[model samples]
Target: MSQSTDFDLTSSQTAEFDLTTVAFKSNPYPILARLRTHDPVYQYTSSPDGQSTWLITRYEDAEIVLRDERFVKDKQSTLPPEERAPSAGPAPSVSDLFDLGMLKFDPPDHTRLRKVVNLFFTPRATEQWRESVQRISDELIDKVESQKRMDLIEDFASVLPIRIISEMLGVPAEDSMQLHLWTKRIADALDDPAAFEQVASDLQAFYTYLLALVEKKRQASTDDLVCKLMHASVEGDQLTERELVAMIFLLILAGHETTTNLIGNGILALLTHPEQKQLLQAQPELIKPAIEEFLRYLAPFTITTHRWAREDVEMRGKLIRHGDAVLVSLAATNRDENKFDHPDTLDITRQENPHIAFGKGVHYCLGAPLARLEGQIAINTLLRRLPAMQLDIEPEALVWRTGSTVLGVNHLPVTF
Candidate 1:
């Protein structure tokens, strides 16, 4: 790793950089760069809960933590008996509903849960949805084309993936907005603890809705993905009722959120770099590589979901004790000076790209192929149809959505 004398953050200086701040969320690259350089394994403490989490910033160290089996996802399993006591009340918190999926498990359980739906998300299977994705992208643009000005996020980026995923999961198109609202609330609660009480009703409503949907699928013989999951059995083991709800919940949230941000962020990147946009327009075949570049330049997922240390482990010069939470900054790692040349530059034609935007190891995103397909189709369709499209507001004036795991603008106002 090369050392730079330009900027350095001492341990004390690092503590001042809160990850949850709106400023950090809007532009985290500068802070993350300093962390990677001065403190690769930096420790961050949340002011709300007084819980400490180790932030792994460098590319190599982040990869190590991701691939290392010692660093697990199930924090409960690693907790001491005293810390694992059951709650006195039965009220469900955001974690109760959101963390029950495969993303929160490890080993046999994660493997089993993932295997049940693995085939549905493979590259070949995802290719079958290209026509549907193209149709949805076109329809979304067609609605706004006549208007000449539209919030790209509200009208197009956020709607396309939800529609496709809803159709695949047999969820009614009418329920997409409600589901999106519930998912956003859940994510907000996770990001800001104080918001939990306000969104509790939403959490319960979402859970109840999914439960009813599962039972509905159970009674009828449908051909959607939900029906297939209901009947899918791996090694004579079927998904339990809770598991089914959790799986469906995970699919709905993960299915659209990442892809939504990808389209939004990718468009913004191209709009800011007009040359790259023109490059893609001149050679439409560059869409695939351009999508990859967008992901590398600005990953939709800024940091990974928390991973817990099962036992005391050391990375770099810092020690992460047992039961400690660790977060790998995918956004930071993608821009590591050692990983990619001109890491900060937006180069659509660059070839040596190896980004872990969807994550790595066993927990690598299952819907990556689908997300890429949607991004390619969405961006290509927009450029082809709206040749004069440009950002309506200055880049700095755009408001980025906060209190969520996904990194994207709240509204991408654009005009052609």
Candidate 2:
């Protein structure tokens, strides 16, 4: 998109990096690479919010920040009530759901909340859904077979994850579309401070919907993830009403949004890389490894959720003060030449690939197993089912999602 930088600190300091532009969103790798090479720990005032955040780009530095307890998740832990960024937002509003979720919490509180559902998401437990995942994948493909040409994202990629997660949450199929739309709006607000007010209104509505859903599930006591979590207790400590709602909100939002992008982006990667696509097509056994490559090459999330410093900390010759926000660039770390032989090249047969696409340490992705299962099944099945599948539109015509933490194309026109 723009001229590549060779880690020129002077040029970077003089210029401002804009994350809101189409060019940046479409291809942020080049800039990310420059930061990794020239300035591993770069600090910048965000264009949208004007908030300062340290960008940890190098693989070693990112891993250290992600695992280090000194850098806490909930900014409230380190800052005082008024000083902290809303520990629980405001009373009676679901706006605080994010702060309550385990993503934003440090040890003890984070450990307790994450323990509630960790068993269900483990690789062993998630494998039970393999057959069901395969069935869902086939059903989705069957719908688009007659059409021949379809938006791969809407018609297939997006549908599969929402359906799987919706069924897990015991939500009726009819209501999934509404939840998806609301989640998209919430994700949009995450990257665009300008949309905060609108997203707040949407959150209120979503909170109300979840409140009703929880009551219904409680009354029925069905066999689903919601019911299991409702009854789950850790060391005799059950989830409070507010905690329950927040947990469900986190699951629904993270469950589908991340995987939706994973499937959509993975498919796009394979389609664009004909040699790798052909390699997989010729050797179906390479599907699993290929899926990992897809995750590393086209990271579903460009950056990890925000982490705040608990105290003054010095990293990579930069001093990070208390309550400062930090973002780890997973895309940059994944492509670091220090870690991989040929950082930019896509190789399906990559062995012992230590990519942190799902992150590292205590807060690593909980649903990673399920995401991998869905991705492997979805991509392999799509390629096998539609042997001649090809992009029906030019590459330049593609439009990626904007002002969002996640990375994915909005529409992928393809035909078989």
Which number leads on TM-score?
A: 2
Give the alpha carbon lDDT tens digit for every residue of 108-219 in model 1.
8789989988989999999999999999889998898999999999999989988989989999889998888887666645656776678888878988898889888888
Candidate 1 ranges beyond 4 A from true positions: 1-16, 80-96
Model 2: per-residue Cα lDDT over 1-416, one tens digit each: 11223344455533435555555668778888877877788887664446777888899998889989888887778867666565574564675577578787788888898898897899999999899899999998898898888899888887888888888889999998888888877875675677767788788888999999989998899999988999998788677777888988888888787788888888788788888888898998998888788889888887888888989999867888988888898879999999988978888888868899899888999999999999889888998999889998887778877664777888899999
**Looking at candidate 2, what is the lDDT of residue 271?**
83
Computed on alpha carbons, the lDDT of every model, listed in order, comes to 0.84, 0.82
Screening candidate 1 with a backbone cut-off below 3 angstroms (N, C-alpha, C), the clashing residue pairs are: none
lDDT of 1: 0.84
Model 2 TM-score is: 0.94
Model 2 residue 58 lDDT score: 92
| TM-score of predicted structure 1 | 0.93
**TM-score, each model?**
0.93, 0.94
| Count of clashes, each model | 0, 0
Question: RMSD of each candidate?
Answer: 3.4, 3.0
